[model samples]
Target chain A: MPETNKKVLILSVNDEDKDIVFRPADTLLGVLRGKLGLTGAKPGCLNGDCGACTVLVDGIPMKSCIMLAIEAEGHKVTTIEGLINTKTQASFIKHFAFQCGYCTPGFIMVCHSLAEKQPHADKAVIKEWMQSNICRCTSYQEIEEAVASILAEE
Target chain B: MIPVDFDYYKPESIEEAARLHEQLDRQKMLPLYYSGGTEIITLLRLDLIQTKAVIDIKAIHECREHILGEDYLVLGSSLTLTQIEERNAFPLLTSVSKEIADHTARNKITLGGNICGEIFYREAVLPLLLTDSLFVIGGPQGVKILPAHEAFQQTMQLGRGEFLIQTLTRKDFLGMPYMSVKIRQQWETGYPLVTIAALKAKGEIRAAFSGLCSFPFRSKRMEDELNRKDGTLDVRMDRALRHIPAPVLNDIEGSAEYRLFVLKNTLTDILTVWEVEQNA
Candidate 1:
């Protein structure tokens, strides 16, 4: 059944459906960081150019800042908080993937998505997939190493 | 940056969606039909475009389905670039899209949005123009199908209450040897300075280029010159390109001279390769 409403109910972390009332302009990033208190997904660029607001929507990594909160109806939304205990998180430290740590959450979510799709993504694949994320810290090589190490472990 | 306030509608069927659009247009509501919403949201936030309402077309199951027919490949317009790339539906599409944006953005950038988008370098559509493709459009007049080249002309030229539904490709296109070369001044995600796509089938060549004009286009004069095969491959290739109308595209990323240089040398190489393969 199709829906016709401004408010959308999304199955958020832990498969809990939450009612999110948003202005037509409210982005998923705003809702996640403001209303839901799921601040794991940082806000930056506001446009799709930056990946700081990336999240998993229905298992697909999408730019939350460019996604309308009202558009996520009936879809599953996962933030960096959902990845706390995951191996990708542990591997981040193991591979020394973070510098200054501002972009770690975004990279974690992307790595989680990549690991789910291709558990053994090589360094080339990791570099290819991570182009969406922009880290001013210039820690990309280490980030790629971290992500590839996790994928290689599988 | 927050977006301007607007209404959102998700209709169940194509007819219902079209009707809603008609009703909205009649009221001068300035409705916009969107599927992936990636470009829509960004443009809205950046104040690049505005609308009073956004109709969610993803609710229609038809827009999400991709069907591989016996003689044709039917790709729902709303299919994301990442989805098509992952499925390897078409080699040209996969190669072009795999490098577009990033992992997450790809999930939200649909085929129709890329083809009909405002910014150029829409390399995905470059290959489609060379092949026998068609656009299935849904509007107030119900469903209508138009050839790919004609549809490309009418795309974004669509009237107030219309949307692209799907794309139809002849299966024989799969047998055509295709090439897509993009010269980007920046990193992987950087916009291409020049995009060239060509298809060789039945001893004929069809080529389309972008980032070289106000919009992407194909050059029949160039194609005819190359197909004539009157002289040496290298000279004919250069002469054919010289026939392209100017001013060829010159943007911040590249100057017109540089675009022509890259296009001439790269296209010549591609044509040379094709000539060798054909003669062999």
Candidate 2:
């Protein structure tokens, strides 16, 4: 791979921040999985079609697969693993929102971002926002209900 | 899919980016300038765009400012739809942007990328058409401000390679009603059969319809009929409905006739609402 000293500072919500220099060819996903050992962000559909690799870039949900590591420099990034709250995690278990749990991390990340940005969003808007992430196991109904319940309580 | 090996450069400013483009050999060096990589990544993955260098323009500070001035509203090229929605600077545009897929897609997609890439079923283009927005393009020659419609026309004619710096619209252009109707099997990745935008003011209607032609087209004949003294729009609508060519777009998703019918229905619906608002 061609080499260039492109340093990126990743400020995770957990205070586990790090600054690492990457090559121009490295994607955000590549650096996260290969170097950082943060495997919560699943590598599914490197293209932007599937939102399985969604993450919060500067408080906005984005597909980490398509973004270059260098593009994320000077921006705050929050991944799925960093989204666990004592309350929400308890509610996720109480509501039973996961089936096989493969796509749970992405959903948690997206919902966390949405809740932070728009906690008052209605069910229709939440459904509209969740359309980007596809789940093959048909667990969206439960996921939708859980998200709505959480928002309703808050 | 990983993109082919290429040199990457992030310019510090828009002027520097423009100068970088000017220095490159236009023919020999295929430099692709990108603000956001939502659409460009597809081309890069397919190896359709064989460029020696990819210039990232997000580093330019001027490209990210959203200026709500007294006379005009200027949206920097790199401004994301999410930013626009949060600010509520442009309500109609924000409504349309929210309707598009989800937050993730909106974050990666930029206003300049949407206009420059010319993605079909575009919500921004329709609202822009209704408001008569102008695009500020910075090229090797100099900066040129072209009407939004003319910008799309010129870009569609010449293909892509120009840098869109910002989009500007007059603040006085108010009371314009813009609406979009799309029938999709699924909300995400669902293509619209037809999209119509109507700009009605002072009993005058300037309407445009997409999915009825090669690109979005103004219905001057329909507009004229709406403006006529004895022209009750109910009867004019019947005539206008017929003039809309059938099956303007035929794809796997929908037929041309179906698109025409949707376009007519959409126009009728929006015009009725517009008339009610005008009368109220």
Candidate 3:
């Protein structure tokens, strides 16, 4: 039997910070949703296309599904569930940015990443950066407006 | 969905990685080396590639250095586009890399990964071609310096076992107004219809077009036309437009005629911008 062991740091919205040993076969998304039970980072396209499984690895936005768990051993990981702040939550509700709400978490995660990095980004730059994430509900206008408003406040 | 089960090894040193590859040498254990899993993960999901052992080269420190010399800029294999953009050492290359996708994808995707993957319209390759870059490849035959165009052509023929250690580009070709245009439905999907990259040095102009051909190609006919003694672009522009290949790439997003039309229009627009800048 072949064995490979690697340490991984799993950060979730849940109160516990779990440090687990993983096999190289396990992906970062697998560890987050399967082992840790934090499914906010939805698994829409596991091949890094849908942007559903987006997360922040060491303060940088990344598609967790394509990343190996072992590669994120010592890095700080932040997920959508972890981004629920009072200000952000208030802005999300005021704008009514979500329709079906299935894509809300991904959008929020991306927004959080952007806001943290470039809080003063203009409307056009935000739209350009958010182009990587697709919203099937066609509710991008409101979402973009809401994000712009939030950035304006900052 | 998780990828197929495979033994994983993280090698901290290049010698260890080379030794492991030598040991596994075409055995039943199919080995695929990965720096960042952006493209490889998709290949795994589609079963386009199957591997028994996966070598993670992220931990190799030697493959992660970016050395800027007086004459050339050498970027290690593990250096991500985000890192390059942050440095802003190569302005033209940085512009092309930023336009590849959003910052998220740029953070994980590495220079060597895209080069070794050999996908059409790989953003890094375009700037590298424009700058006449060279690739330092580490293979069973030992380390060798390969011209960027030749390396890309050879990689398309042979599978990516030979590791591309670093990319080298001439540093003196800086401060030139460089532009790259990519036509796509969305910012981050399939290949572009046509991409035009141009560089202006003094009175001489160098430009190349890709995404319409089987591979990224230089428009020698177009360059020759620009070199005429008349200094008037009217006839040269006509000749250049005539030399553009017909029946442009008919892919999932666009028609062949549409691509060709866009290609010609884009070339004209870029040349016009260059002419205006030169006059100014």
Q: What share of the true interface contacts does each candidate keep?
A: 0.72, 0.42, 0.54
Scored against the true structure, residue B232 in model 1 reaches a CA lDDT of 82
In the range B1-280, model 3's lDDT, one tens digit per residue, is 5558777877777667766666665676777778877787777767778877877777777579787888888888889988998888888888777766566677789987876674666657777776778877775666788887777652333323568778888887756678878787555554677777777756666776667765666665777786665755666776766665433577776777787778767767887887787679
Q: What DockQ results for candidate 1?
A: 0.63
lDDT of 1 by residue, A12-82 (tens): 65377776666767888888888789988888787787788888988778888888887676678888888
- Top candidate (lDDT): 1
TM-score of chain B of 1: 0.94
**Model 3, span A1-154: residue lDDT tens:** 1134434545432344677656577788888888777788888867666677787787677888888776776677877777666455567779998888776777777777778788988766687667667778888888887787777777
Q: Report the lDDT tens digits of candidate 2 across residue range B1-280.
A: 5567556678877677777766653545577777777776667767766766678887777678798998888888888877877787777677666766566788888877766674655556666766788878776766788888787651332224458888898876543555555554345454566656666555577776655665655555767775665767667776776565333778776777776666666677777887787789
lDDT of 2 at B201: 52
As for candidate 3, its clashing pairs are none
User: Candidate 1 — number of clashing residue pairs?
Assistant: 1
Better of 2 and 3 by lDDT: 3
Candidate 1 per-residue C-alpha lDDT over B124-228 given as tens digits, one digit per residue, 9 for 90 to 100: 787677886888889999999888788785134576588988888888886678888878877767677777888887889888887777677777898998888
TM-score of each: 0.95, 0.88, 0.88
lDDT of 2: 0.70
